[model samples]
Target: MECGIFHTPYMRPGRTDKETFEYSMMLAKAADSFGYRDFMVGEHGMQAWENIPNPELLIVAAAQVTERMRFAPMAHIVPLHNPSSLAVQVGYTSQLLQDRYFLGVGAGSWENEAVLRGQPGDLSEAHPRLLEGLEVMDKVWRRQPFTHEGQFYKAAWLEAGIEAGSVDHHDAFDLKDGEEYHALADHSPYGGADGLEIAITGLSAGSPSHVLAGQRGWTPVSFYGGSTLLRSQWDVYSAAVEARGDVPDGSRFKVARDVFVAKTDEEAKEQAKNGALGHAWSKYLMPVYKKYRILQGFIDDADVKVDINDVDLDYLADHVWLCGSPETVMAKIERTFEQTGFRYGQIAVNTHDALDDPAPWVESLRLFATEVVANIEVAGSKSPVHEFA
Candidate 1:
């Protein structure tokens, strides 16, 4: 139960970016004061709730203000990035942050990033495109040259370079109409440099992508938005890993989800029930999350609609989120462990309009970490784990 802070800098109707930045800074500074172990930020280009549209820049700002916190993206849309270039920037950031770097990458949702800029949001055609992009990035960081020829993308006779204390964007682009769209290189070390871990949020362990990676011995950062929903998903994934004849030593799976913790059972429910987060539910995730729920083993069909109003704060507060007073929050968290068997309870505590109230959010983080985390035992494991046993 390693409690941490997750921020989604939302632009509430009345606030300016400067005001928002000021408030977000307050939250980060508070996380520092409160002695939190990690602070993660997210990236989304179009949503109002997604203010830190570029989490890497935000990470630098957070690192400058805080003394120590393992910083990462809840995940980045890796497929959209030039992997070689991503490697350099992340490597520099990781070194600058002095090894407190934990990089989380995802193929991502919302193909609309390119769509909004007069392009297409078709990951159906882009994932394989970006997958090869990552290959070039992997080799380039190790001072190697690699060529690529894959559907939707290609690179030939290329190399990239890195320098001490700076990110020099080397041979790192496949330009179309004078705009660099992807990477062309011989070798890429996007996740290998600095011992960075590669993680994937998937449909399940038995899903071809997850199982394929597992078969080749890549430990994935397995994610589930809710615990109960993923219990069966984890079972399937872990079983696939074990059955693959190449399961990694220890459980190399991480269950990362959004969680909120509070002091009193009553307060916890109120904190999470409806205002900011439920607003978020209404705005973004609920509309799209249902399909994944079914794909992840929760429901048979994907008619996903969550009436935010219908969500019982108390039931969800106690059951899903690690929320309650110190005594109660701790108890629920322990129960979460017993039930989920997940070592990593990655808590994305921040939500819609939440960062706007910097002071209280920070205080809640401190209360959860000091009061609840101190009383609990960290389920011991290094690999991202899916199930409890």
Candidate 2:
């Protein structure tokens, strides 16, 4: 039961983008000091409400402040860019981090992002495009010349300049051919590695990406989903892994949940219920669900008679959020594992603008690490909790 943090950099009423950026980095540094396993930042292109156009840049800055925490761009919206370009960027960043970076790729999901890019604001085409983009990246990173033909993208005899003495003069420079002949691989950012860790996210339960994860041994992550949906995703992932003659393990499965913690259960609930967590669902998420007519996708029970139009903050808090004192929060996570069969799973705490004042937010994060994580780790050993100064 490892813990990680994912920040969405949610914009609130009065907080400037600068303030949000600083606050997010502050929390990430705290996670570093607390010995969390990893820190991940998400990328969004057009949505002003949740803005952080290039999470990779932020991860680079964070790497300077943290000593051991691994960083990832939670999911670079794959359909928006050329895979070849993204692959080089990712490869360069991985080498810069000295292999401390992981890649998470997904189809662009937010409606504004898709429409801004002149594509239908739907998931239908994005999935195949995402697959093609990843395939191109794979071919490009193999350190050789390659070609790809796909419905969404294609490459014709592009060379990586990785093979010894295979450098092309055109790839060397834009200057008149008199310029010094140099290979891109001669100055390759990744010293010699072929690739880095790869992960895929499923926008929907049991998506084709889950099968890809199983086939490729890539980690699978689901964002802010209920246990029922997560279990369905794991079922699909496990079946695919078995089909490929590999054993599936929960160690690599990650589930992100909206979490807040406090010194006491009552205080925690009061803060979450009255602060940004409450407002985020009521004002932003649920409204979007209703507008898109996809509220059913988020609800825990499909048979229940409920109106998506009438869904409110309380319903979301009870079903989706993991909020309480350390003990209560740990219990909820344990139950999530039991229900979803994520026995060796990692818990990614999804952070947003939970409060206007950053004090409670910082305190809540500290408590989660010092108390909830300490207790959960010891419970497995049937040993006494480690004393902290």
Candidate 3:
């Protein structure tokens, strides 16, 4: 399986934006040097914990510092911006990165983000808006002059300057007799003949995003969801693809997980529970998860009897996180593959802030990259693990 890093950069308070960005760059460089295939960064507007409103900027910067690692916005929240503007930006970034860029789009999931944008904070319209936005972007990328009059957004580029001949006026600056005017330049993504790859992420069971991924032949990303949700996502994705007379390729599916590796199972567990991962979950993510009522899904999936309130770091370490020695983490990955019956092509390690001292955090990444990844197999074939000199 291909391994990568998914960075939300759940940075705690008190750090400058520049500091946060540099930290992300550090992770990107590390992942790239470690032979990761891709690096995904999240976009959030309102939340301080998950900062980095425009992940495209980060990806652009990351592309300069790292070679061979592809980059994408874990997702750009579609409902939060004008689709036309976003389309141009995405196109420009894709052109800049060439083959190293893909697009990840999402309907806004956080209610506060909606409220911050002066909306009702209801996500009922988010999905529809997302679809409309994507349609607008698709039209833009096709290099066609078209008009869209959708319920959420209206866009038109039906007139081209080239279609109208230049006026015979001497006032025109530096105009030659034979000088020809041109239409708007093409702003399509740069991914050779197949076009740019679009990835959509799903966190809940029976997520429509996965179905949409299948229908559009975009990459399907399962983000930090448990076994049940993973299976459900694959089921819906595969069903949609088959219904459309297309085969579902597991190689396009990406599964993001909170992972950490140490010298031993006990050492990894202690670090994960007491270190940055534990603090981030307790202080930031758990509250959001509780607010969204997402814990019940995990509870039901695990068949646990603990109260949602009581679900602490210990619970997460035991049930959710792949924290252990290389051997133990490999076993967990193998189990997940067997349980879901889907040999997902990519394993995106959900990254967290390393906080003050970066030794343990960096060590975890090194071990995961060098050791755990080397011994893992996907679909009965050993991975081409990189050998560090």
Candidate 4:
């Protein structure tokens, strides 16, 4: 599969926001230069670990520096903003990037974020609100005069026009009527005469959002879950798409995984255990996974019966993470594909803090992009391997 980078970027403690953003830019530049397909960043309003509140700003900046890498908000929480406003902003972003942007939407998952945004901490209405918001955004992007009276939002778009010489309108160029002047007449996506490419993140097994993605024919992005969870998600999504008389394509599916590569397997394991990846897991991700009881997926995927408490860095290195030498990592990737029967188009590398020592992190990304990727035969497989057959 083609490679990509997914930056949730759990920055180390005491890092300034500027430093964090610059670090992300560094990774973006590296990924672009390394020939990655896309770069995605998570959007979070309150969490310091996942600190980017507006991923669009980063995407815009990265677009300037990168040549061909596409960008997306690993997801923009749909329940937090006015759908029309977000639609317009995303449309503009897509226009600025010129085919380098895709939209990823989700309901706010964190209760604290929901509470901070003046909603119930339980987020009871978040899913329903997300559904309505997505519908409103779709309508808004159609560029038709329409009104929406939904459960969580009320919005309308009225068509407005400007005549060539009406109401003392100043034509800066003073061009003839037949001359083409590129104006923001349509706020739809750039080259979105068809439709904007939308993706949805699915974390938990059998997530309904993934089902929605299948029904809408949007990309289904699976978080760094183990093979079992990935298979479950694909099964759910494929079933949904099949029910709707659509064939599920694996190329539209993205799978995120924590990856680290070194000269040797032992070195990679040690670095992953003691370096930024380890720090992120020990300090940030593990805690959240424990709180949300997300560690069971790993536990279930392991060969031996392991308690959630025992799911440490070593356990992860052996079972969940794709950390090793290039050869080992490639084998792991191929194994995952063989097990799941789905060759994902994009292998989104789950990135962590590289502030402490950027060399190893950068090197790992380089090896994965250059060596491992070059060695893989199924890098561009668009369909499920033997699944449909």
Which candidate wins on lDDT? 4
Q: lDDT tens string, model 4, 1-389?
A: 57888887677767788998899889998887777887888998788788899999999998998887889997999999888899889998989988789888888689998888788998898999899998898888887778788778998876654445554667544667766643445678887725678889987888888899999888888885667778888999999999999988877778888899999999999999999889899888887777765677767766776888878789888777889999999988887787778877778888888786999999999888887865666544432212211
The Cα local distance difference test for each model comes to: 0.55, 0.71, 0.81, 0.82
Candidate 3 lDDT score relative to the true structure: 0.81
The better candidate by lDDT, 2 or 4, is 4
Task: TM-score winner between 3 and 4, please give it.
Answer: 3
Give the per-residue Cα lDDT of candidate 1 at 84. 55
Backbone clashes in model 3, listed as residue pairs: none
lDDT of 4 at 333: 86
User: By summed lDDT, which 10 consecutive residues of candidate 1 come out lowest?
Assistant: 380-389
In Å, residue 327's CA in model 3 sits off its true spot by 0.7
- Where does the lowest 10-residue lDDT sum fall in candidate 3? 380-389
lDDT, candidate 2, 173-249, per-residue tens: 34356554334452223544345677777756676777888988888877745566677788899999999899888
lDDT of 4 at 232: 83
Native-to-model Cα distance after best TM-score fit, residue 172 in candidate 2, in Å: 15
Give the per-residue lDDT digits (tens) of candidate 1, residues 267-349.
66676665455455555655455545532232221134344334443434544445567787666555555556664434435
